[model samples]
Target: MDVVRRNNVTVTGNPDGPVVVLAHGFGCDQNMWRLTVPALAPDHRVVLFDYVGSGRAEPSAFSEERYASLDGYAQDVVEVCQALDLRDAVFVGHSVSAMIGVLAADAAPERIGALVMVAPSPRYIDDDAYRGGFTASDIDELLESLESNYLGWSAAMAPVIMGNADRPELGEELENSFCATDPEMARVFARTTFLSDSRDDLKKVRVPTLVLECNDDVIAPREVGAFVHDAIAGSTLVTLEATGHCPHLSAPAATNAAITEFLAALR
Candidate 1:
């Protein structure tokens, strides 16, 4: 099978319309985009793919060293676009994937026309003058939880991590998504995601960018989103009324409207 197929690429919507590539965040795969895809599919050619180890991807394709860095994932994005011969396609990435989008756009400015970063965080650990919403020790504790009680950690942290405490169902969905991933693979991915520092790469973006910052995102605070917005030249930052990191899931309507407006303005 082709490389894109190995990644479990799923294409929908208008065959000849403007292309929109949706990259899921850290925990889950393309399925997480279920709530948001329908909105984009009507007008755009929507593309969804699972990262190597996360979703329905080929098990043998995942390499620990390759995925330990964001660049490897960025390469996947570039390859997906190249395999489809997509030029100037709009890239929409959530959470850690958002920074991956930034890296991809920088690497191939000609391939990506615009970028949308949902709850993006260039860095997760606070450093010097930066507020990344987490402390080094906090990350250590998180890793410890993952190691000690992988299942329990998944069940407990998913809700807290998802935010939107008022709605327990959303957290349940995230928990299920987190548990579906292979535990060992999830561990490595978590380390790679949280320890990663992509702050410097933001300025290299040569395409029009949009940063969608959600309210009450513990993983990516408002400061982190602002950092991304300030870092990328001429990037638009929109603060959604949707509370929680997974606004596309909990508040799909608002998330859909924001993405629609952003894509529309570009056209």
Candidate 2:
């Protein structure tokens, strides 16, 4: 119910069927999954919500220190699951939320039945052996860009997020999301997204999982997708031929079809 919003998120979905919790990534809110929800709602109970600072969540509820770490966001996921009494839930997370889902599922494995991670990265930064698909400098420039321009960074970042800055609407969409955030909170979110490393936690995931890889995704490169697939045991990997980082937007049908088939297989 509404009580779940106390810590983080604005939840929505069917109450009677099996729970399907859909989480969004950084710099965006649950609205990112709007297109994907309609397909899942009629058959399964669906849960769509914004993280503590993003989406329709009250701006006043966000905390810089509390949400500074991934655990804070993960805790919100756990709390919402507990409040709703959701068991054996299917968690569908995008980008950063996918990692958050991993952390939450690890914490409460008994409650989660399966995971569908879209554009997930266990560790974004590359190690000696692990190529997480990005370098320290890549993340540094991202943080710097976020700090300097903020709005302009989003405008520029949108094309990167959208994978098509040339597209006029991508610029506008990016502006709206960038401006919608609270400056301080946004800074903290950016820090969390770029800084946290969840590779260690991947081994802790005990439930059935699926990794949905987006081809030509800038945020989560194909290598990162391969890394996630290899790291998680007994997880299926599907490469989606979508251009933008947001597959649910750029290729909802493909995204939905993959998910629908996976859920059906579970049944």
Candidate 3:
């Protein structure tokens, strides 16, 4: 398969510089990294791609069964890196893509230099010993909400997920991003994101990792970030004041700075 066109891969910045791959979370494409990409592109090789069924990717590449699990998405990450011949690249993933990075790095450890997880959670559903910030019932309710008004769910839930009551535009932006995705694809991605468990994968990460935790993310709580930090050996945890699940959109400056600082240390 032509991985480039398969995922709508785009590359920018100095060809000789270290590579940085930005993976957008569910409900969004690579456009979500617009604010942060420019900052990294000047000094690093920036790679951006839309997962199959996302952005302008070839729709034929999206297989329902393949995408039913995140390992498929992880495979996409590795293939993108392989096609581009990327090595020792910094993989920055938002929300669920963060876990996707984990899986990708585990599969091809040498390709990834480090990982930066923004508002990530291995499991969205809470367990008796773990507080993932959402219960199984809550996940069902969330699916129910999305199904009840599949079209409107994105617009309505954006504000709640963003957590910036004072900033209406931020929520509006997220709502737009969410609603712009293909509905059926969005549904499957959401299910894979919330229902899957990747807790054990954390312990297997060999590359340096950073977990960025927002203060008031309704989806991934501070505790969940801490748990990821603890589970991944020697992982750095940075608490941000972004107050949203999508900090790359709501607080790009701080998010960018945190990522910059982490990448600099690897240099």
Candidate 4:
């Protein structure tokens, strides 16, 4: 068995309750769930952490080639659960991390009791039957933006991450939270998030799952969320009437309520 040493894990809330591991999206890290922690803390034992390359993770672990696919990130999630000795945990993930959680849950279904996938996308690219919300040109443009001005693109994309561009201050704060990684590392992480497709793993998720989709998200739109719901057998899909890719920040109340309700139902 491979032992993955604990990286930058931020745990909070009840220590004795059922474990709830929260994973953040691309460009952002554990801090993105700050608003969510307070809500889940009173009842659930929440565990949050940065990927090996992002947030406050040990930068030495980041390798563009190694983490080029989703499996690399999934490995980190599995290692985290094993290191913490968490069992039957509720794995919550946002944006790209949502897909990571799915992959992790598939890898270790025994450890994960349920999956709360927020704004998850199994595949970002479009195929004949699937609409991943982003066109090939759109992704190319985003990659070009990353290449042109890494910092600027991060700033520009911050609103999309938080789902509120009118609040430039929020975007700035998100950009700061995501600024922990170097430009090269950020590029690597970005490529991994945007390129990998986890659609095939949806059918393999054995645990009970809930796919929460934001109302009007450009990144993972409603259709994609529905696709996930249909693909993942026995999983329920709920739409949060909020805009943006990061609902945990934009609509904490609704997000928390949905999570609470779902967890209660499982009990």
Better model by TM-score: candidate 2 vs candidate 3: 3
For candidate 4, write residues 158-267 as lDDT tens digits: 77767777767777777886665678877877888887778888888888899999989988888899999999899999999888887787788999989989988887
lDDT of 3 by residue, 3-119 (tens): 999999999987788899999988888998999998898889899999987777788888889999999999999999999988889999999999999999989988898999999
Tens-digit lDDT track of model 2 for 1-267: 364565344445566777889998887877777899888988888876777788677666677888999988888788788877889999999988899999899888777889999989877788898776678999999898888878878776777777755566754675687778876788898899888888878888778898999888877888888888878999999999888788888789999999999998898
User: lDDT (CA) for every model shown?
Assistant: 0.91, 0.83, 0.91, 0.84
Clashes of each: 0, 0, 0, 0
* Tens digit per residue, CA lDDT, model 1, 81-159: 9899899999999999999998899888778999999999999999999999999999999999997888899998999
Candidate 1 wrongly placed segments (more than 4 Å): none
Give RMSD (Å) of candidate 1 vs. truth.
1.0
Off by over 4 Å in 2: 7-14, 165-167
Error of 3 at 136 (Å): 0.9
